[model samples]
Target chain A: MTFVTITFFLFLAVAFLCYFVMPKQHRWLVLLAFSIAFYLFAGWEKFLFVLASALIAYLVGRKGTKSSLVFGIVSIVLLLFYAKAGNSILAAFQMKESIIVPLGISYYSFSIIGYMLDVYYKKIECEKNFFAFLLYMIYFPQILEGPIPRYKKLAPQLMEGHEFSYERFCFGAQRALWGYFKKLVIADRIALYTGEVFSNYKDYSGIYFFVAVLLSSLQLYTDFSGCMDIALGVSQCFGITLDENFRRPFFSKNAAEFWRRWHITLGTWFKDYVYMHLAIHPKLLKLSKLAKDKVGKRFGKSLITIIPLAVVWLLTGLWHGTGADYILWGCYWGIIIILSTVFAKEWKQVNQFLKIDGNSKGFSRFQMIRTFFVFSGARLLTAPGDLKVSAYMFRHMFSLWSFREFFTKGALVGILSVWDVVIVIIGTLILWKVDLLQEQGVEIRKKIGQYPIPLRWVFYYGLFFATLVFGIYGPGYQASDFVYIQF
Target chain B: MEEEILELLSAEFPEVDFTASDELVDDGLLDSLTITGIIATLSMEYDIEIPYEEIIEENFNSIAGLASMVERLQEN
Candidate 1:
């Protein structure tokens, strides 16, 4: 069920009631049953696929053997590959693929794989209790788009019996409502304008395409982070704390920092499972040492760091989708970050020679704006269906760089007006400001709560009204699925 | 004994000043990933496999705790 839908609210209400009323020890059972029922409601046919996968993982994990662990890992990987690429494989065989990728299969498969790997490596003990394992894998809130809870982070919480707390509930509900505002009101509305321009990019000129790129970036952030807020908020209602996903990504002065802030869980997952492992490989270490001895520490560190980053980005590109544009987008960011690091010393030298203050507030602000534009331009490649169209879009973007044509013109006027742009800017600023505060270890809500109740209530009511009036809801415009769900 | 482990810790994390009585896990001195790295290193250096159950914070509370565990494993 869509998090924004009435059916989801109903399910949550029922689950909440049952969860609180149930015996303390059996609270997990209540959640497990509700989760299963929720998944079944969403996609009953696919329930069997999820169930079979979960069971296979559980059995393999419980019955420990080196070979069993290897087999389990292989089986999970194969299932994911088939789920992801089954149609292409079927076409090659001259058969129409009957396999429907279960809703949330991409997400839960990672959870299952991570769990099995942890167990295999003996990093974490296997959960012999089938229900506990199921709950960890299928918790409804995160089943869709995950913070991708590790086994250790989630399993103990499921085992702990939580007494209902009014404070926790209030906090969760407020956060959920805030998420709704972001997703339905801000993100979906912005999407309308971005979708219009991007879908017809061939007809737009310089500034128009530029605006579209900016709007698309904002829309994606709001939609994905909004979904994350709701998922995390819902999990909070049950006192199951999921990891924070997005920080103030836009505030990042560099692409590397941007990755650290955006989709944080996924970045860390790649770091732990992929990057760090490869970074510390004996071959790479030897190469790094050799470079350090030959070329000096400065050049060696840059080479070592940039090489691994390139590989990580390549994998990251392929992981997003089986498309060339995505690959280019990933490589593009990778190159940007590498260049930034490679030129760090030179950049400092140049800044010093030019007598420019790198620490000046105005200069920093300009750099941030420049970085945003550059990132947006790179992401424009992601909008098109293929590399050819993407290349055409890029060519047109540069070729038709007339300020008058963009401001005066055809496709731009039809897509976004001044008011829409204003709203998007305001919304993005608010999100960035909030994330910045949180990153600095400020307790935003707590500080807000210190205000007079009447003021707090006013703020709350204003948020609610804004959402209700502006939220993109009606027939024929389905809530777009969370982008990370496909991963 | 704890001082020895602290020396190792100091070598790995130059910024950290390890104390024998410090609550390493609770103070966030060691994150889960770091813990995994430590376990892997301990196994290789000391030729001891730490069972999953032994990974609890009680056995890794301080340098002394880890050293004691390592000593026990060596004896075994």
Candidate 2:
């Protein structure tokens, strides 16, 4: 069951109640039961896949041998590849649909592989209990669209069940309410416009495509980060802290910084597992020396960045999807990052030549806006889910750019209703303001908690009621699934 | 060792001030790419292999950390 549904809320309530009621040592048992039930609630058909994958991981980790490590990594990677790319490969062979991909296969598979690698590398002692490892692989809060947890970081917390605290609950509830506001009030509302414009771009003008790309970018950020918020908030209520997946990504001044902030867990995963390893690999290091001696110091130094980043970006793209559009999107980001790193000094020199203080607040703001548009350009490539439409949008994206029409009833007539536009605009402003404050190191939830009881209750219940009242939930309106769940 | 390594790294990466911050890795002075470059330079110059376990932040945060790590690895 999706987090947005009433049934899931009921499930969470039951889980929450049982967790606090149970003894501390047995609380993990409660969590395990709830996690399994949550998975089964989604469907029993894919249950075996998760179980078997967990078993494989357990076996590999228990063995902790070189061969088993290879086996573990290969099997997990191949399973992920089959699940992600099976449909495309089947289509190529003119076969019908063949694979029933398990829930959170992409996420759990990576977690398990990371576990196996850690085991072989002797980073942490392998968990002696199979059930504990299984629980780590299938934690209910993180199973769907994870800030994918690391074993060393998350497993010990899972085993050591925490006593219930009123503070954690309040903090979690407030954060979750904010997440609901982002998803239901902002993202879903904007989806009405982006959904239509992307699906039927031919019906609208060039300005519409541009608007849709920007909106879809917001839709994705809200929907994905909204899910992360719910995941982390729910986990916190149970006295566990998951990693933060987003960090005001829109304010990033460059592609590298943006990736560092956005989907932070995924970026760290690639860096730790893939990029760092490749950079330190003997062969590549030798190649770097060769290039330095033969070509130049700069070129050799850049080789470290170029080679590992190329592989990391390609794999990153494939992880997102096996589609050509995703490949293009991945390459689009990869090239920008690689070039920026390779020519950072040259760019600085050029900036100096142009007499622009790159560190100035105005210039930083300009860079942030530039990064947003660059992100929106990548959105244009894959948001339509087809490269042809993306190409067409690119060709005519600036055709009928009339600000008067855009600002007036032109946007209101069918594209976006007055209410829809208002909610999204207000939501965007609130999101921006909150992010700005947080960027300046304000702990918003803590600040709210410091208020007197009456005022605190007002802030808490005000948000709760706002989400309940303004959230787009009525007959004829279906809440969109958290966007990253499909990945 | 600190002065020599600082000179070496400064000469290698003219963009960064090696002695500006002790928390180089934590303060974002040394990104992953730069860290790898430092590892390469250290490995090639010192003729010692730095294991993956040695890649922690404490070892890369400052020149003293690097010099100590290199000394320990060499003694090993």
Candidate 3:
């Protein structure tokens, strides 16, 4: 069940009660049961995929052989590949209908494989208990989408039954409420505009496309990060601390730093497992040496680094989807990062020669704004089904034709009213304020907690009533699913 | 040994006082990119092959840790 629905809250409430009420030793068992129930609630047919994955990982982790590790890793990758790409393969064979790609397959597959690999490398001990491993694989909060927790990080917390603490519960509840506010008030409202323009780009051009596309970046950030907040918040109520996924990504000064801040778990996963491994692999070392001799040092190092980076980005793209546009978007980012790395020294030198104070606050702001636009522009490739449509929209954006139509009330009020626009602006400003506070290392939740009871109650109830009133929910509007869930 | 490691770190990241903090990795002093650059330079300068398994926080958290890690690797 999605987080927005009443059914999910009901499920969480029941699960929470069962967890606390059960005998201490059996609390973990209760979680396992609830996780299974949550999975089954999504679909009974997909239950087998999760179970099989857990079983394979557990068995292979126990074996801990070179061949077994290879087999286990390969099996998981193949399973993920087939689930993701199976339909396209069947279409080539002239099949009438394609199979459904199971939910959480991409996410759970990575978590499981990471566990087995850790076992293989002796980073963590093998999980001997099948049930514990299964619970780790299918924890309901992270199952839909993930910050992609490692076994070492998540498994022990699941086993350590937590005593109910009022402080923890309040923090988690407030966090979840914040998530709901962002998802409903900000993300969903903007989705009405972005969803319209992306689907039917031909109907409008110039500023309409510009506004929708730019706002889409904000919509995506709030939606995905909002889901993360809810997931992490729910886990926190259970006294589990999942690794954080975002860290004020918009404040990053460059593309490299932006990626490091955004989706931190996934980036670290690829870094630890894929990029770093290949960077130091024997074959790559030999290649780097040969390239160093054949070409200049800078060129050679770039050549070696570029290959693994390209692989990571390509897989990152495919992980999003098998679509050509996704692949193009991946390469676009890969190129940007690679260019930055290769010319980093020269770029610094050029800035210094030009007497630019790269460390100054003004320069930092300029960099942030530049990075934001570049990131938004790259998102255009992801918004449209066809790359040509993105190109057309971009062309119209630059053409300045019919630009006067942009500021007119007629265009802006088509999807949402002026009041709706005002709400969105205010909501965005709040989000920005919160992120800025976090970037400056302010403990906002703790600060809120320090307030007197009356003020605290006022703060909490104010948010609750505001969400109830202003949230984009009603009989006509279906709650849009979190964007990252598809991945 | 600490001084040698400090010299290496200073050459790589001139902005940070590497010796001031023992928790270089724990603090925000050394990022992943800087860590990778240090590893590459150490590998080349010392003629030591630091494998992926050795690239852990414990081995690179401070000048002393880094020096000790390099000495152990060199001996091996």
Candidate 4:
């Protein structure tokens, strides 16, 4: 069940009650049962996929054989590909086409692969117990959209019995409420405009297209990061800490740093497992040497770095999908990152020549805004359909720029109501204020906790009711699924 | 070896005092970009193929750590 659903909350309540009432040693078993039950609710067929993944990881990790490791990883990769592109692959082979994407197969397959690699490399010991392994692999809260927990990071916590703490419960409840606020109040509300404007790009031009594209980017962030917050908050109730996925990524000064802060676990996974390995491969080393001989030391070495980065980006693109638009989106960011690095020296020189103080607050703010637009522009490639639509939208956006259209009745009324606009503006301001406070190292929760009980309850109840009243739902609006869950 | 590593680090990260700081990675004195550059330079300068497994914090967090890792790799 989705995080926003009433059924999921009921399930969580039952699971939490069962977990706490059980014996300390048997608590983990309860968690495993709940995890399996959660997966089963999605689909029994999908349940088998996760079970197979857990089994494969455990067997390969336990065996610790070289050939088995290779076999396991390759098998897992193929399974992932099937989950991602099974229909197309079947069609290619002239078989009956069926969409067989197992729920969370893409996410958990990576977790299993990572576990097997770590086992083979002897980074962490193999988890001998099957149930413990399954519990870690298919933890219900993070099973769907993940922070992609590592075995070393998550397994022990899963196995260790946690005594319920009132403080932990409060924290988790508040965090989950905040996550709902972001998803329901901000992302779902904005998705309407983005969904309309992007799907009907021809009908809208100039300022509308740009506004829609920017909203899409914001919606993506809020939705995905909101999912992570819910996952983390749920896990926190059990005293399990998942990795932080977003770190105020909008404040990033460049595309490279933006990536480092966004979907952090996925980036690090590729870095540690894929990029680093490819960067130091013998073939790449040969290429590096050749470049160094042909060109100079710095540029050649930069080429060496770019080669692996390109591979990472390509895989990253394919990881999202086999779609042309997805590949283009990946390449767009890859080129931006590569250009930033290639022109590092020249950019610095230009800044100095232009008497731009790189450290000034104004400069930093300018960089943040510039990075936001760059990221937002890149996200246009992720619009519905192929690159052609994005191209047309871009052409229209730049070629037909008009200030008056942004304020025109057609522009505002076609997508959102005046009330919706007001709500979105206020919601965004609240989100930014909270994020800014957190960025300044303010422990907001703790600060609130220190307040008198009446004040604290007032704040909590205010947020809870605000989420209830202002959240977009019922009647015409369906609970919008998180953006990253498709991947 | 420490002095040589310090020299290399200083050459790459001209702003940082590598000699004074021990928690270079921890303190954010050395980010991944700088770390990658150092790895390339060290691999080239010392003719050692630093494996992916060796790219851990303990191996590159400080001047001594880097020098010790290089020495150990050389011996191997």
Steric overlap count per candidate: 0, 0, 0, 0
Candidate 4 structure quality by residue, lDDT tens digits, A1-487? 7888888999999999999999988899988999899888888988888778778889999999999999899989988988778877788899985876888877788888899989888889999999899899998888888888899989998888999999998898788888999999999999989888877878888888888889888888889888988999888898788999999999999899999999998898888788777777756776776788888777777866797788888888888888788788788888888888778889999999999999999999999999999988878888555688888888888767776766766456767887888888998999999999999999889999999999999989988998899998877668998888889
Error of 3 at A470 (Å): 1.7
**Of candidates 4 and 1, the better by TM-score:** 4
TM-score of chain B of each: 0.81, 0.96, 0.91, 0.89
- TM-scores for chain A over all candidates: 0.90, 0.98, 0.97, 0.96
Give the TM-score of each candidate: 0.83, 0.96, 0.94, 0.95
Q: Model 1: how far is B29 from its true place, Å? A: 9.4
Q: Please, what is the whole-model Cα lDDT of each candidate in the order they appear? A: 0.76, 0.89, 0.85, 0.85
DockQ of 1: 0.11
Q: Judged by DockQ relative to the true structure, which candidate is superior, 3 or 4?
A: 4
- After TM-score superposition, the amount by which residue A446's alpha carbon in candidate 3 deviates from its true location, in angstroms, is 1.6
Error of 2 at A408 (Å): 5.7
> Lowest summed lDDT over 10 consecutive residues: which window, candidate 3 chain A?
A403-412
**Which candidate comes out best when scored by TM-score?**
2
Per-residue C-alpha lDDT of model 2 across residues A1-487, encoded as one tens digit per residue:
9889999899999999999899889999998999999999878878888898899889999999889989888988888998899888999999986878888988898888888878788888898898999899999999999988899999999989898899899788778888998999898888888888878878777788888899889999999999889998999999999989999999999999999999998999999889989988878888888999999987887888899999999899889899999898889999999999899889999999999999899999999999999999999988888999999988888798877777775678667878778878888998999999999999999998788999999977877887788788878777988889988
Please write out the lDDT profile of model 1 over residues B1-76, one tens digit for every residue: 6676677667755644557346888887875435655664455456676765476688776777889999998999
